[model samples]
Target chain A: MRLDQIRPGHVFLLVLILGATLWYLLDTLDTSRRLTNTILVVPLAILVFAAGAFELIREILRARADPTTLEQRDVDEDQDSDQTPVDMLRGVVLLGFTGLLVFFYPRLGFDLAVFLFIFASLVMLEPRGYLAKAAFAAIFTLIVLGGARIILPYPMPTLIL
Target chain B: MLDTTAFSGALALLGSDINIWLVIIPGLMIGLVAGSIAGVSNTMAMAICLPLTLYMDFLPAIMFLTAIFTGGGFGGAVTSILMGIPGTTSSVATTFDGYPMARKGLHNEALGVALMASVVGVLIGYVILLLVVAPLGAWVIRLGPAEMLLIALWGMSMIAALGGNSLARGLIAGAFGLLLGTVGMNTAGHIRGTADIPFLLDGIPLIPAMMGMFAASQLFTLIGSGYLIKDKTARRADYGKVLSGFFQVLRYPVFQLRGTLIGVFVGAIPGVGSSVGNLIAYAQAKRTDRDSESYGKGNPKGVMAAESANSSSEGGSMVTMLALGLPGGGGTAMLLAAFAMHNVTGGPSFIDQNMDIVYTIILGNFAQAVLLLFVGLGFLAIAGNIVKVPITWLIPSVMVLALIGAFAVTGDQAGPITLFFFAGLGWLMKRYDYPVAACVVGLLLGRMVESELIRTWQISGGGELEFFLNRPVALVFAALLVLSLLQPAITNYLRARRARQQD
Candidate 1:
């Protein structure tokens, strides 16, 4: 089980969990020396860190045993066997679009941000459906915006309806 | 248990109100719509309509609210089946098998199975509620924090059973979720993981986080797919298939009964409600079934188990609300508010003096359950068409709806931010072959686990072993938890021994 055999993404996730748990446990201790405050957090943090390390070791062993086994193990229901780099890029782009939509929700407003996000997403996902995409983007934005306005008690920040 | 005079009086009260009958359909529709949408909870719907009930008579108001409760039970299953998004936390387990069925082009059957199970579950829940409300309420009140801790632990065990292929990954995900759940304010007034965010004070909002994990993440993964159902010819929604799915529930009578019983009992416990009931039922179904391997991959029994338990939980929750004036969850809390509005308090006196009213509410829910079958069928007819939409269009549209839904849930930018963050996390977990469901369950139960664990600790005077020794109920639950945890291993060992004998 060598470090080179480890997938960076898997290791990062494991480390993230272990690090977050450790930080949370320490933070709870910082907040209070009371046993109640740290009781569950301390034990839970230890369990997660322990599990994360064990998983990392197992992944390394499995990778060392059969390199392809690690790759096969990583492929889940979300990914197809023939998924290409382009598909991965598309997923990342779609995720980026979502992130930007949330980031600009207060700035650009719900209506405008959502409309632009939908329009851009549709165009990106279906490159040949400009007319349909625009129409859908408009209609969906209107329906969602209108429905939210009616249903939600709180007023949403909006540039225009 | 039957009081003849009260029974007659209940029948008379139900007959006296024509508006009660009129509000049932609308209430059901509101619930169905609210429950189908990812962010709008049935409690929210009922709260929105609470003012409308102020104008109605007491009986009508109660009926209207209960109708919403009954309808929302099945409504959440709609999106859960067609998409992986659970409209409410109660419907989370439903998505395990329901979404897979939709992916496999069995959306109609899944919808049918969920609808029928919900209807029957409500009927069974109310029947048991009617017979045992007084006794059940009394017993539920006796359960302490130690018992609750055990129950939460019981729910947490589902993470182990659901940890698909890797128990280590599952434990990590669940523990991480538990940590996230405890973020914000501890019951002891200590805040741990908020990192200075004001919204973190309430802990991470559960619904928005859930939408991100299950819906947004799943949508991200479906980016390159053409449609939800990959098989082009199998994409159409068939009413006949839905009816077949409806009748198919009849085949799993034992499973349905088990789920309903679990729902009622678990739901009767205040604060636990249908969310945990559905998970426990799904896990039990998976544990007991011969073809358990097919679960989480589109098993109809999984859908049936989840829907039945969650739906039946309404009755279980009502036991606490009506008999103890305690709200089991948010939905029942709204019902309690409605009770206060009507100038009617629930508890021993309310039941003792107004047994007829109690019977009327129970009888009214029975009618609502039966009517749900017909009304839910129409709703499913429309929602089941989601399979026909292309993935390109559906993905962006649903994502936008989910983001807005998250906003609605949180009433601020925090909701969308949490949704996005959890979405990325969920995608990574899903991509790495980790069971996102385990993590979701952890997040859902985390705060409760912490609070209960804290209470149990305080009650025990710093975790003395003598405290558990004194608590018979907690000890029983503890034993059950141990058994539940070991069930998988025991089953595997038995199967292996049987194979050796045959060989």
Candidate 2:
């Protein structure tokens, strides 16, 4: 493929393969194979990278045959994000909230963290008032935790519901 | 071992066990609910629900999990039909024709078709299992390491077909999966890629990784869409259309039979499951059908072929799990782990001694399949409304469910963390047109293939010619593997030649 024809997706795929390969080689060097399947790890990585490299090289031939095909397909792929600005913001906020939930649940306790997450989602996802958000969040938490209490083991964890 | 007396005794066991009977409905319900939701796969559903089985007796626990497995097999089609997003990878093929049917105002009909096909598939699969479990189990015993290695090779060969349109991308994805799956400690007790993190000793958590790939990544893609169903009115449940679609499968016995046969055989192979079966079955149905061109355009037969194959995979998977102690997919792998937890092992001797328990599980699945007709309709009617929920609300809420569900799996932070990492990975794969299914197949089968190869190497002991001989089963499977790889090319070539002749 030409330099301009090389899309970010291709670069990203190459980087990923490289990362996997390096990691496998480094780890295998550090560890010794015994009665285990460790011997196959690096070979597996090599095979994968080889296939990926072969795929990329074949794209070169295909591009030569149908010059526009590669560029058009790459553009379509790179355009996966079709959201409007407002919609895009909403998605970003949701992803941020997920990160926060994962980071804080252990520190905040499951019920508190989960309830907060639900309330925040309700408020941001729609134009609900504060009382409505709180009510919705409360009901959701109660039902979820209440059922967990009944079905799951008790003395939950870290004062979790 | 599977004489008439054993069959009747198995029936008696199933009838006598009210506990097993009661859990089947609940299990089916749980599976249906979990599966109908976006991002929450049937495998993740089983993994999350695994803890619940801790309280039940051994037989009841296994039966309950199996019911979830059975119920989950069909539940995913609901989302695939009504919503464009597949609830699980196994249901991905359903989205091709199913979503089109729904968009064209045949939503109820599509769902009904999926339900009917799924039920018939399961019924037919179990019947095949019952007939072959004993003999197959005995035959598999003779398979040896050489044969098992060939089976894994066969599974890997299917990855080419899975790449969607490109064999190169599929092989790359599968290789990535294999490497990722091998991150944990080798059988020799030496950790390979733990990065010094203690939890990495088990490698990345499979269930969490799957939730990320199937659920979170898909959710990310959906954040731009206003509604899952554009017509909006199609979101509502129409009982009349559902019933009509349900009976539609009866009109296509041929599709049902072909799909079920494909599901059973493919699902029986370790490391290969419904994902490949559905795709292959749909491809074959399209290839042979008179109205082939209408396949991906809301054809009921397409829906039937895909759903039948996938649902039948549940039985096919159970065959290897119960008979050979081999897991065909993550769900069956979970079953094998449950077997260990309950101090129950399933193999030739186990089945021979506990023939009644074996029979009970199969019979219980049959009951679950019949029960699914009612339960699934109610579920589709209710869960089908998910299309009405906006992306803003659905995305975060699903992430929350996934987080909690992941936390529940590991009882620690590793689950949620892995969920985050894989979500990003899955999204990238999706965005780039890479088949994440190939990666999942690689992950699922990686360990099995590696171990089988090692065992084969040891047993062969540098005498390749001797170990390779005297194995008729291996030879047959080897032929099947090669044929499966070439069939697509053969079919495409013929189609092209026919077009040229016409011109």
Candidate 3:
């Protein structure tokens, strides 16, 4: 079977790999290897994976008898079947916009970059009223920048200079 | 352990230190405002406030941090009650009772209950801190990675409670979180999934990823959910009735003590925080309520149980961190880092050596509770006005703040990048009707769990599960895990059978 086909097996494989990786890393640390930290991780990982596997197998089993499971059918029927391309496109756009903001943040300066990112994200969400959008953006920017200056010491490097 | 001198000194610092108070007050106010807004969280508020603490003295910095935490906890209930949308995960339980009460036009009463319960809960937790910090500290210190791993898994089991009816989907989301947690370099001295990116070396910061998962995803949902109704009709409850509400909460001694105890214990566990405290307390209250059917409606008892319990968790969580030097929750982890940066370490030794500081921190939580009662009540109206801020503007503002916080935490764009990654995943979990809390818990505990499991395997000579069965304590815990997983399904099955029989 393909890896995804045997869902629980895939989970076990992942857990095993993750467990091995952590063990290797912890060995390299110079600190006291507290017995609890060293010895208890294996069972815990095994238990989590086992629980997850059981849940997955049960779900698959239930799905197998889809016609017989009237309750399951009823519940599934209530679930939204109409996932729009617009939502998918919107997700892509959100991901892209976030990437662009991070990319330009160093060059554009903290204030400008943050402002643009906020403004773009808001506009994309399509909040009502232009005035509401502008006012919120300005107010939020002021509070954050002003709060940082007065209360926190995190220097916002400016590109203006 | 009861460092009276330190407690007094901390109080003196609060009263006399003009500069620290200045930082504390504003930070508290900002955190309150941020936490009250739908889609904003205490974690997000603290992350935003973190950069401000960088320049201050350690005491003042710590004071400001805890103040935000205290204020944010109360602030979350405001939106939860008024708009039927939880301001933070902690308030998710609050909405069950608080919103219903609000709908009945007893908004003031609900607010009063929440504020009073929060204060009482904090006091109970502080008392525990004063009495048993050292003993508890020593005990927790003895807990190895093996035990910590079990505890973290216990915390993750909260996903079952949070996941609602779909345990499978919830575990899947949790599994996804575990996968994301492994994206950085592993404990094995080798990078696993960094894809050769240098910034991924340090791993993702908890705060930024959480801000994205909780805040950004909420913004997405808000867009889809559409506009919230304005609650201008809100009437102030008789301010005098605040005492009456407190009395009402006290009358139920069992509820108060049980919820507070739950809060303290849950709070002591690393990775579990107020959100779980509220959830567990609410569930417990429901089970214990004589009129259990009245729960999830306008039950003031539910409000008291959840709000008080959540507030208490802060006190319990802080004590464990100070005594053990092991961070029990996100807030304490931040506190731990702050101490390390200042060349200070907290643990049993710290309590013994610097009794004054430890006492002062404990006193601060008590003082914070008292302060929250008065300030939260007095400014409810002004704070509630935050909801009037249009969603269009509010969304952008929050995005900017979350973006800044994310970037600051990582000192690079990767922080914000992780936000998008998690936010997308968060949105999917929501869309699929899965539990977001499970994902958060899983992500938080993934590393600790993975490392401990690996270590345990090595110790067991890389073999047989029989070793877990050998240790009596581990075996008992293992048995409990099985029972916990099965209990829900069995209960539901029995309930269904009963209904059929009745028919």
Clashing residue pairs for model 2: B39-B215
TM-score for chain B considered on its own, for each of the candidates = 0.97, 0.77, 0.71
Q: What digit string (tens of lDDT, one per residue) describes model 1 on residues A93-136? A: 88899999999888898998998999998888879868878888
Displacement of residue B134 (Cα, Å) in model 3 is 2.7
Which scores higher on lDDT, 1 or 2? Answer: 1
lDDT of 2: 0.74
Candidate number with greatest DockQ: 1
Instruction: List model 2 lDDT by residue over B1-503, tens digit each.
Output: 34677779888877776898888888899888767664456776677778778888887888888878877888888767765556565787787789779767788899899999999999999988887887765564465767777766765654554566566677778778888877877545667778788888877877677767656546766666766566766667788988999778888899889989988877776666786678768766766676766876789998899999999988888888888888878899889888888888877778778877777778778888999998888787786666677665666666766665566566678888888777767766766677776787677667667777777777777448666776777778778767766665687889999999999
lDDT of 3 by residue, B1-503 (tens): 45567667767766766665555566567657766754455666676667667788888788788888877877888766765556555676787788767656566677778888887888888889878888866665555555555655665565554454555555556665665455465564444445568886666666567667666445555554333323445444456555666677878878878788878866776665676678667766765555766775688888888888888888878878888888886678777877876789988788888777776667666767777777787667564444455555555565666666566556566777777776665665555455665566566656656666666666666646786666665666567556656665666788899999999
DockQ head-to-head 1 vs 3, winner: 1
Candidate 1's docking class is medium
Tell me the deviation in Å of residue B17 in model 2.
8.2
DockQ (C-alpha based) per candidate is 0.68, 0.45, 0.18
At residue B392, candidate 1 shows an lDDT of 84
Cα-based lDDT at residue B500, candidate 2: 100
Q: Which candidate comes out best when scored by lDDT?
A: 1
**Cand. 3 Cα-lDDT:** 0.65
Q: In model 1, state the lDDT of residue A90.
A: 81
